[model samples]
Target: MDEDNWDKLDEEEDEEEGDFSEPETTTSTEPTSNDYMAGAILANGIIWLWLQSLQMFSGFTSRISPSILADFTAVTIVIAGFISSQQVAKRSERNQLIVALRSALYSWAGSLFMMLTSPNASITFSLILLVCLLAGGVLGSYMLIQMRINERKRKLQASS
Candidate 1:
């Protein structure tokens, strides 16, 4: 057969033998609840360590008592993270964002609760928590909005 005909034949054979062995590398480019959980765990852990070091070296274990509530909060954060991560894996970016927002809200609530319930939680520490929560909310909201806008633009472009 001529070179051109030979090439056509090869193409036809390739079409029949499907490339089924190639795994679909599906990934969520968006960060999910599980990501939040991981970050919270890390941050909380660092805080815990810092607290511990201060107590050990400086003898400043003043008002922060290691309580059941603290453990519960940590567990809750992890659980929320897990739920969000699952949503992300299912390609639910909005749900993931919702979970993140909820977590931030909860953090704010927890901070407020701490301030009211514990006399030892200093004003300075409370303000720091508030700042952290505000920053997280702003950043998460911005990301969510951007994702939504981008998706809308893509759909419009595609339809056009």
Candidate 2:
């Protein structure tokens, strides 16, 4: 460009640069996994509490027998697994399937606790829940393996 145009452009650039905001600096650089886990747990707890409040308002729990409650508990555990999966997804796609599977295992353990506490609940139903839990775990593990394989291929391509 002409000398005058170049000078005008440089002046405009300097003016714009002077108007820019300064970047903030902090000491903490990385977020902890516990932070994500805490958020997930808090969200799930709030949802469960809401469900309980609904049950109270409708008198559903009182109308239903302990058997129904047991079933509801099982379903709640499954829902928790789903929430955990979502939390993992939010954190990162890598190893997400594995994290979700581990969460499913945690759900199974929670349901097992309820089953053990209830005297009238059948062992058979608990076994069925366990089977479903294991199935989800297996599927999650398979996905995790696939993710690992893809990651390896990516690394190989980058290196080559």
Candidate 1 lDDT, tens digit per residue, 84-125?
A: 333332344555456555555545554456458655778766
Residue 115 lDDT, candidate 1, scale 0-100:
53
* RMSD of candidates 1 onward, in order: 11.2, 9.6
* Candidate 1 regions with alpha-carbon error over 4 angstroms: 1-105, 112-120
List TM-score per model, in order. Answer: 0.37, 0.41
- CA shift at 106, candidate 2, in angstroms? 8.6
Model 2 lDDT tens row, 4-78: 999999999999988895766655433245644553454346435745675676665677677876666656545
Candidate 2, 65: how far from true, in Å?
2.0
TM-score of 2: 0.41
Which segments of candidate 2 are over 4 A away from where they belong?
A: 1-35, 101-160
Which ten residues in a row are the worst by lDDT in model 2? 28-37
Top model by lDDT, which number?
2
How much is the lDDT of residue 109 in candidate 1?
53
